[model samples]
Target: MTGYGLHTPIEYLKGVGPQKADVLKKELHIFTFNDLVTHYPFRYIDRTRYYKINQLQADLPAVQVLGRLISLGQIGQKRSKRLVAQFVDDTGIMELVWFQGIRWMEKSLKVGSVYLIFGKPTLYNGQFSMTHPEMELYNPAKKNIGNLSLQPVYSSTEKLKQFFLDTKGIQRLQETLIPWIAKEIEETLPTYILKSQHLIPKGLAILHIHFPSNMAELQAAERRLKFEELFFIQLKLLKNKLLQTNKFKGHLFDQVGTTFNTFYTKHLPFPLTQAQKRVLKEIRQDTHTGAQMNRLLQGDVGSGKTVVALMTMLLAIDNGCQACMMAPTEILAQQHYHSLLHLIGDLPVSIKLLSGSTPKKERKELHEALMNGSLDILVGTHALIEDTVQFLNLGLVVIDEQHRFGVEQRAKLWRKNSIPPHMLVMTATPIPRTLAMTLYGDLDISVIDELPAGRKPIKTLHLFESSRLRMFGFMREEIAKGRQVYVVYPLIKESEKLDLMHLEAGIENLTREFPLPQYRISIVHGKMAAKDKEFEMQRFVKGETQIMVATTVIEVGVNVPNATVMIIENAERFGLSQLHQLRGRVGRGGEQSYCILMSSHKLSNDGKLRLQTMVKTNDGFEIAETDLQLRGPGDIAGTQQSGILDLKLADLSTDQLLLQEARNLVLGIFKDDSTLDQPKNELLRKHLSRQNTGISWDKIS
Candidate 1:
């Protein structure tokens, strides 16, 4: 079938009736024939062979077999009948049991019959057994050897499984669709391109992916499919970026160095780090170009990305354009406002803060000032994006923690001006270079690789919960030296039903151990009102509270220079990135800071690795890389809610080489045929259109 003509709705497919098709549409989001074709398997299970029952071991996910049924019986009452059967092969004797369907098993089993049973083996009552094993009765007349082949396990809903539409049912559909696909779909790419790139034909790839005969065939099929997915995605994004650069003209801000130099020499309090200087230069170069700037600034906890952002904002002001900085939360917005106020205090620029908490009258006044170009810089949360708030001549929009905002919200910031504003995004989470290129290929990237002078490295250590007394002693010493401490717990409320420790109970215990008369302790959690939480955070920031007991809500944008000690309880429960963020809450001051990770004795290998990685390195990029390795790509970049692109086959951690190859291929192809309409590239266009439909293609034509 031609790509455009193969537009059959999924309900019309063979074996997928209306009812089952509805389930596929609702659960797997498969609504069309193409969607069903592209619904790839997450992982393939090799079921080509089985192990003898005697070779089974505990705590292993292995398939094993039993010999023949010697005796079969049903036990228990009518409502709770259990089927018990015994099997004795030449190697060993074992039992087979089923709890849900006793009558069905009695009808299927025969005392002297031999069968091949496949399942996870286990030890029950000091004897080997399998519960609810998949069974196939031996039939010499049919000469069937019980499907010792690789199986495709498609994701299905329980409702579909109840209707006998399980993995095997999906395999039947695949088998029926194979001949149609082979006859209808032609090989799109040239044979030379396929042979040189080591890619299989589209028809062969689809068939082998569902039912491959060997490992080599499966690997080749997977490579071709993964490459196609990533290649089209990169091509579409790069093409969009190229079009934007060529068509849109930007207001060049070339006087950035003059303003920055004047501020550094006369009004600046401290010098910039080498890494910061390099990133600032990159941003300046991007701004001076006729093309609009799209850049991402990544740095570690105290690598000084905010200073770079402030300097870039100054460039906008120097060019007679207004700038705005948007943060994710009210507390973070206020924090940025205070920091910028301190840095540009002596300059002639006017900085203002706006948030949902701002009074009605004050908000109106701020809006008026913003529209009149009186406020040189405005710092706020999503409140800045309200329709009532307008910019006089907005040129630069700086988004801190860019992952927190969605694409639509980020685009809305550009609509405030006639010309789209140049965007500079900042994030403290250091992304791996390959992932940055794939996800942010449209944007130039800069990494602040060093910290400022006088900033001390955080001392990290791991301890068991039994070392609480010693840790408290260390905290007392730090407090005695006029430094503060932060004691963080995992949960907010103490539920009597749960056995885990909570922040409220920990706070109570701390208050009893080190009474409030000796030291002031404040508490914060997600459940508290925003105003109360802000007030408590302010106390800690001002050193009015010596120690703050809180949950993970303070993991980001809470800077306390005097707070030199951080103690995280039950650290094993948190991911590595979260632990790193918590550690970042401290170590902002000139004084030496320490991060104490305390976990229970029972720790998994991943938990141990996370804690050990914390103790081994202070670099956020190293921590991010280790986190990706340990936890995969899901939690590191968050899920789709964080504006993270969810690639189907390419793993951002292990597929770096594949990503680079695909990126280079895209650049080469586009450089040759900008529109991809050359006769040699027509197949590529059809493949892209058939496979990826979400990417906008209007500009390409």
Candidate 2:
């Protein structure tokens, strides 16, 4: 087969038949011969060096040597029988034991035979021993028998291994493919680029990856493969972005800053922060351009993004265009409606709300008013995308909390109008700058770095579970002072299936400790009905409940300013960003707020770092940076749902410099030859095509 072509079926390959091939396909996802060849080992066992029995430590994993086996014996009867062999090598003597598989080793081992054994060595009662060490027959003709070298450990199922297709079997397949790859595959990269990058050839990389002679060769092969994977994935995303930019034309609302300036001059609640003004200016530039403005507006909580979005919406309305804002939930949509109604009260524009639960009569009226240009601003959840809803002239579509919406859902909103509406995606979760560049590369980004006035910094504290009584006393004092409290647990009820039953038990204990008569408490959780959840939320919002005990459902947009004390049980269970969002809920009011993170006495390294970051800074951006460092790009910003690029090998956190270099090189190549038809560019294209089969470069061109 050629380099870019598929390999023959595994059934046709040596040793493998239809039944064995079926097992390999089901267990390892390996269907073809090429799939079996390319299923790389997760880890390599280095056997190049061996340690004497005396040097073995009980805690650390080490490989030790044993001398010739003087005698081999079996202990116990039939089912419970175990084989024991004693030997000595260099420094000391040790015993090698194997259970239930003594027959195989008995045939391989001979009395007074010296064999090389490798396994985790353990010391028990001043005696060293290894359980089931991988053994081989002693060979006197082999040179430098002590130099064992590294062994590639490929993952395999017991059923497949029973058929002799284990790691060693896979290694044999790899050995067969190496020569074919070298002879049939052509070098797609130019010599200059390959030499400049210090990259190994494809054939050499494949061989070294499977069976490296040294550590340096293994590292080089890994680097080359990882970089190639990242480069092709990025190339595909960039190509899609280019196609969108060239094809999609925006409405391009004419700039009429008169209305915007009037609101700022006369009716503005407070002076706009410099950060807000800067982001607004950036949005204005994008809106006035003819190209569809796909921009990401990112800011920390309380960064005045709502005000900026309101101003941008007004700009569209001033130009005789309609605007809509889509929020992730109904509560957030209602909150936006209330805030905008208050902000634009004196203006002539009409603002309306349409949620999933909106009355049929009200929804019909909203649909009619929107189509007749009676509605200037419409705010809702996914309900706004229904077929009956139509806009007079939808110009701008603002999506609040961009991570919550799926790609197809957003696309449905874009199709609500003839020309795709200019998109302004807003996210309250601040992302690290390096990650933002890679994830949101297709969209221009504007960050609001400043918080609005009267926003007090929240006081954060970390406490162990042993301090629960003292924490409860402090919570009671705060409640006595007329401040509300929120107690959040990770789980709603005790599950027989889950390991963490403490959260559910804690909730029940809290109910008993602070009974409803003493403290008006309301509970909300994920499993509750929507109406029940809304009722509980309303009770808390109306001050009928002084304390709210809930799960992470309140993590998104449940705004209650009266709540001053926030307590998270088992804070170690949450991610850094999630902890930050839960903390954001309490500090919204004028009163002083405190966030107390309660964790167990024992914490993992990452958990300790997460809690420490929370205690050290109230700045969401700083917390986000720490999260990016601790969790890496894939988890910090969920690539699958965030519309971010899902990279196979490139780690956005550690490989920022390499990512920039790759981006620059790809951009430079495309700038000179858009179709990548030049001799050098053609090689780069072929290289990418071989690496990423899912990306259709021909369609892109």
Error of 1 at 241 (Å): 1.5
In model 2, the worst 10-residue window by lDDT is: 692-701
Give lDDT per model, in order: 0.79, 0.78
Q: Tell me the alpha-carbon RMSD of every candidate.
A: 3.6, 3.8
Q: Pick the candidate with the highest TM-score.
A: 1
Model 1: which ten-residue window has the lowest total lDDT? 692-701
Give the CA lDDT, 0 to 100, for residue 551 in model 2: 91
Which candidate number maximizes lDDT? 1
lDDT of 1 at 20: 85
**Candidate 1 clash pair list:** none
Question: In candidate 1, what are the lDDT values of residues 1-701, reduced to their tens digit?
Answer: 34432357877777888998888888778787667666666666676565676777767574746478999998888767789898888878888889976788799778988887777788877888889887777554652122425666788778878766676666666666654664555676656557768899988887777777678888888888777667766776786677667766676897755666677777665688888888888887888897877778888888788888888888899998899999988878998999999888778889999998899999989989988889889999999888998999999999988777766677778678887678888888877776677667767788998888998899999999899899988988998898999999888876677556789789877887677667999888888888999999999888888999999888886888899999999999898888888999888878889999999999999999999999999988888888878876666554455333557666777877877888898788889887778888887777657655353322211
Give per-residue lDDT, candidate 1, residue 275: 88
Global CA lDDT computed for model 1: 0.79
